[model samples]
Target: MVVNEEGDILLVKNPNRGWEFPGGYVDKEETLQHAATREVREESGIEIQVTDLVGVEQISSKRLNVFVFKGRPISGELSLSNETWDVGYFTRGESLSKIKLERYKERLLRCMDEQNTPFLLES
Candidate 1:
């Protein structure tokens, strides 16, 4: 997730997932951090400097593992890509209300607190 100076969280409205942080699968040629930065830029037109690893999520149903990161925007403006229907920054309360999926909400809540050690969630 990318947060601004005002502590607003950046979110993208995925057609399938509703509202969630900008992210996708890591490329085989890219590192985890590089993929995170690239996905944010591709999905939201925002260049970000990833600061920390928030957690890892294991989706048993899909046999996939998602690496979540916390970051701040280094530059670029918010714009939508084919992967995103909407892109914007929202306050903590607004973000929580905007995201409908429980797993997505959990990721956001976990990322908002930087003090927490990296976590692993399985579902």
Candidate 2:
């Protein structure tokens, strides 16, 4: 998940564990982009526009659907929902240390380093 000039990647602090991108399982028929956007909004209360396909990754027991996009903050103030504890942006280094999901941290760094290229998935 990506956001504006602040370089703040939208993140949700999961109640069950640590921080993660605001994304969930894709519905049977929903496109990955749709899922990414919906998940971000649902979890972070921040509506974002998904611009490009970032990448995908599979870890341990789950298949992660990662989509890196340019998001413009549409509306809604950040709030902690049932699934998330906090929602905000942090610097790349900060996110690396603060993000709870190890895979997400890896992907975030990859996305940043490869921002000029198309999405590429890593297992």
Candidate 3:
């Protein structure tokens, strides 16, 4: 999750996933943090400096593993990519309503709360 100085969380609208944090599969020879930074830039046109790993989620059924990180925007303006229909920063409350999926919503909430961060979950 990337948060701006105003405390607005960054989000991207995906065709399949609606509104969610900007992310994608890690490329070969790329670190998880590097992938996160690249994905954010590609999807939202925002360069971010990742601060810490917020959580890790694995879904056995889908053979999917995701590393969620907390970050701050370093530069760039909000722009849309082919992968994302829209991108913008929103308040925490607005972000909750914009992100409809429970799994994604949970991640955002946990990342936003310092006490509940750095979590691990498998499903």
Candidate 4:
């Protein structure tokens, strides 16, 4: 997830899944860092410097490899895209309540850790 200097969490209003951090599957021949930067730009129309690979969520039933990256916004204004309806920043406590899905909330919490230990969350 990308955060700004004010300690607000960035959220994208996904048309299908409600609110979530900007992320998607890595494209062919793309590095994880590149994928993250690309996803953020595509969903939120912002540039970010991906700081670290903070965690991974391994969902068995869905067979999804979700990589959680910590990032800071470097450029661009808050704009909407085809996949996301709204882009906004909120506080940690605010986001905790606003995010609709439990699993997505969990992912955001994991990535927000100050200690930055990589996690393997399975479900």
Which candidate model has the greater TM-score, 2 or 4?
Answer: 4
Order candidates by lDDT, high to low.
3, 1, 4, 2
Reference-based TM-score, model 4: 0.93
User: Which scores greater on TM-score, model 2 or model 3?
Assistant: 3
Candidate 3 lDDT by residue in tens digits, 1-123? 999999999999999999999999988999999999999999999999999899999999999998899899999999999999999999999999999999888888778778877888889
TM-score of 3: 0.96
- Worst window of 10 by summed lDDT in candidate 4: 108-117
- What is the clash count of model 2? 1
RMSD of 4: 1.3
In model 4, the clashing pairs are none
lDDT tens readout by residue for model 1, 2-95 = 8899989999999999999999988888999999999999999999999988898899999999998889999999999999999999999999
Q: What is the Å distance of residue 104 in model 2 from its true position?
A: 2.2
- Per-residue lDDT tens digits of candidate 4, residues 1-123? 898999898899998889889988898899999999999999998999988778888888988888888899999988899999898999999898889999889788777775756888888
Worst 10 residues of 2 by lDDT: 58-67
Please identify model 2 stretches exceeding 4 Å from their true place: 58-70
Between 1 and 4, whose lDDT is larger? 1
lDDT of 1 at 111: 73
Clashing pairs in 2: 54-119
Which residue pairs in candidate 1 have backbone atoms (N, alpha carbon, C) closer than 3 angstroms, thus clashing?
none
